[model samples]
Target: MNKSNIAILVLIGILFSSCTMKKETMPPNILFIAVDDLRTELGCYGNTVIKSPNIDQLAHDGVLFSNHFVNVPTCGASRHSLLTGMRPISKDYLRNDITELTLTNKQEQDAPETFIHHLKRNGYHTVGIGKISHSADGYIYGYNEAPSTKQELPNSWDELDFDYGKWKSGWNAFFGYANGENRQSLKRQVKPYEKGVVNDTGYVDGLTTKLAISKLNQLKKSSKPFFLGIGFFRPHLPFNAPKKYWDLYDRDSIPISPNPMIPEGVNLKSLHESGELNGYKLGEEKASLNHPVSEQYARTLRHAYYACVSYIDNQIGHILKELNKLGLDKNTIVVVWGDHGWHLGDQQMWGKHTIFENALKSPLIIKVPNKYKSKSVNSIIETVDIYPGLMELCNIKLPDSLDGKSFVSILEQKNMQTDNVAYSYYRDGISLRTNRYRLTKYYRKEEPTIELYDHNSDPFESKNISNDNKEIVEKLIPILEKGNKEIFY
Candidate 1:
């Protein structure tokens, strides 16, 4: 018990405290990756057939939200919901041209804009490549016309970039083929599936990966922490990829949809005639509730879709490798997300405009630096929650008017019970999904005003048990009404 011994112990304690404080004060960078029209059909999600090693590894290293949904099923509206952290308050917000007239007409002073803009204003160097907003290159342009000079999300990023390569523009690159012809130039006569003999560079997603890697290298020298958004367009229409990707899948082994028929007792108005898939003039067959697609065609289409998913997974693998190579993985919060899910001949539908579980359920994986432990959460979460969640994780100032509640606590606590209900809208129909049931109501005057499906009994939603389950309908109607009431006033 000497004075010298007491002085030495106090000095050691002070040094240890300083090291912990330095680690806590350092801000982390962000790498946000968006994939288009991807579903929960990966090896990580327990789909044994499809091969997705890289994405699966990410899930193994990060936390996966098992039941993640979008506020809107379509691409533009869904991304708007995520970026703005709000639901569709107006008709314009529900459509693909989310910024076309709304941004110009509706002016709010001192209002918080998209999350990217907020990040940029808060000392983060924001950079976007590919389709972060409604447009392909974060700029507005018609699908067939030449590219325009206007930015879709103005003042949101320090740089907006895209590498169109032989396609010349972002829109063209989205639909471009191996032979340098796009659907627009071909007048929409392209087939729904194509296997090219060229390498991965023959596609637009490959070029996107190259540009993102280059940006990472450049950002490494910058003094401030960065927020980089990278979007990949694949597993979408005209499913085209390299021959090597296609070779990875055996055509005969691809499986068709287990629940391919239209749900019993469901109104026909609730479904559509696979319009997006039929848009390709060279498509062999038409799909409808009256007549489903042939099994052979379905298998072929599934094979192509799986190949595209594998291709995009490879591109993701490349970008993640580049991040680790640049030594950014340890200090960056990496997120891999799909804007919305797609239907591979589910419910006799081929696109993503429905309010069904197949169209709304997508993949979500978040990896925090030095905190990854392969966690999985089954609580229902919406895509709008991403905005506030990122802000909270980065320790940035959160603004008012955010509709999403942050889920950072869910990452820290394994058994946390998050908001169990997720709401989605498509056209005039609104659907709400709870832990065990999905209740949908159409605003239009239809024969069946309410459609209810018990997820516990029918996970595939093979039948609409609305008529038989009156008790469940009564319990869920009030919840839906309250959500509807919020849309106005």
Candidate 2:
């Protein structure tokens, strides 16, 4: 062949390689959905009672983490750990006001160093709606005060927003009842649950879903890849939902907890007296281990919770449907995660304040662009691990200081490994979850200093067999101690 023919072939080869590189380098858009106080009680997670078709459908198309645990069980601290990709350093870090304090006292760095901040720096348009942080709209405000100008995560989002609707501010929207009365204005004398006859838009989460859907349309036109975080507040408290959702279940048919009593041989300090539930003084009889709640009320509470779950599922379904309609689903990575789990009268506790299995374990589902086969990973993984996982998924550079390691490989492998372990810290208690056991250690010098439960034998964690299993306790103590160093007791 002549030199001219060889030159023509090389030019064609160069153009083809350039196109391939450009396509490979294009970052995928991220749709991060955060649900509040959601437990692993959905139909997908083997709970045959709850009707969560939308979330179950998402799980059918993606990966469902059967053993996903959070760093902290409460809302604020759990979200703080999730956003910062760090463990709790002090007792103050465990409070609901961590967002208000941290953003107020931001470090000398030019920009906030949260994961979303890093994403913004990397040419992604980060938009947050509703309660991504402790605040409802990612802004700071008092209990009954108007929304302030202060942003909770200053440099992390391009646009931090919320639709308070009838309730004036994000805080108010969070505690808003069907009649626009909040827990504060009513002086905490509200009922524990409500069955509103209004539509989905009657509550705050419905408004949030509307705003998020609108933002999705706008984000579709952006030049750069986008990271949209939509946080829903239903299934958190005052379990209010449309009567349509309430009608989905029979109140009498809801199953009560098999083990309603406090764990045997467990210290009372290890459990709380359902303080959050007791705050709603109207029609609520305080529940305790000694004086257990009535079985009828327990069933009613469970019914309300399931209704809220289905209500949120409908909202999620709407947002996901819009994503596909806009042709964004092909290039977007969808993640539906619960900040932490909740206790629905498990161990006679109605709130999430302990290091128990029900409080720490939540639902986590992820769907990449091309991988759509249904898969469930039963390995131990922490909420902190989300940062590195998303970074790896989007081909972004993982920061060296992040406490979590990427689970992208685990997704590809589609199986659990023997070495998988998750660590969680709440107050002075430090717990570690392994493949078959959950071992918790409180920083106290007492007889019940340790609490261990074998998940293989007792999945519900009804009994604490710490004292009986001396050999297992000896083996897991050092593992739990490894994560305890970060928490200053």
Candidate 3:
């Protein structure tokens, strides 16, 4: 290596060594919580209608990242990127089965298997509950099939578990309804939303919370520092929550999506027909890309989503309460992340799998227990950056093959000195999200293939201004291509 490169490496080594020395006495435990398909519309993110008081309180107490995007909008791929500290280089990285197809049933090797495995290798006992990886309970199984004996991340967790409750299996609990039935078992003959008149333990997320709380009690008594991962499935499809959470908001109080129409000047490739949301065969409305859903039906769906969000928020409140009650809150590094964002009728789309802002930007909050105060980061950061950032937080040596950079310095400084950008890939499109602009390039043909939306002027992404801003498009294409490690299929 050149002299300057060698010197930089030496400096980084010394810095990491110092952090290691600091954590010798009492290494912080991590309470890594991942929520499935949550958007950035919480009260903390400036949404006035949603009742996410607990999440808002956490944002008040921790650092809130306003511009957090995932590498891909699909669940498994996004979580894989977060675990491996890598970005999408090929079509395999874009699939929702990336984790199960690659990591499940694989043997542990010399290098750490994932960020969880990294913690396990460094003397930390890692425990995972619910869907930390792609599988609902970290087990490999089809949505319509019986639960299998396979574990998703065999090397990552010392005690990987999920309480299936009455649903019987991981996939059932994942696609489960308020009653014992699930969409898979019912053959998709169910409605898209539910407001069951039951208690907190009515839904699967309630049971997941109960399991997480029980695990926290056991972990507090353990001798070793623990890395507890709690994953909650909520605000996803078949939005099911207790009636109490649904009662938290009036139907009219919930607002409709501001940008429900397709942005002008964009081709048909940029739009989706909400197929995932329509998979619940008995839904009242089938979403269309050409015209938005009826106004009242849109509000009802948003209400269901709001109720689910509040339900998960309440579950998270219970977990954090137990953490503080056990006195582990002071020493635990808490991270609450949403795997990816949902459209919620934005841009006439219902689910993820698009490179739109709503699909890619999710909620991210980190509390390092006095390491950093409550702050907001507006600069863009992708999900791949999270794995290395966690390693740095725990004083572990980051793997050399990581495509992400630790945000520890950004946390310490509360500012972005680097060129902070987030890149996302989906459906033959590569999108770059910066603080001010979103530039997207699609591989489809026979249309105005480039799409650009200036966030500074139009945060809702109402129109594609690429033709109007040729100078900005030329300036950003090279930067976007540099981050694409494309191993074309």
Order of quality (lDDT): 3, 2, 1
The true-versus-predicted C-alpha distance at residue 223 of model 2, in Å, is 0.8
Candidate 2 weakest ten by summed lDDT: 103-112
Put down candidate 3 lDDT per residue, 291-321, tens digits, no spaces. Answer: 7789999999999999999999999999999
For each candidate, the alpha-carbon lDDT, in order, equals 0.86, 0.87, 0.88
Clash count, one per candidate: 0, 0, 0
| C-alpha TM-score for every candidate | 0.93, 0.94, 0.94
User: Per-candidate RMSD vs. true structure?
Assistant: 4.0, 3.4, 8.5
Residue lDDT tens for model 1, 129-176: 998877888888788878887777766878988888999988898888
- Candidate 3 least-lDDT 10 residues: 480-489
TM value for model 2: 0.94
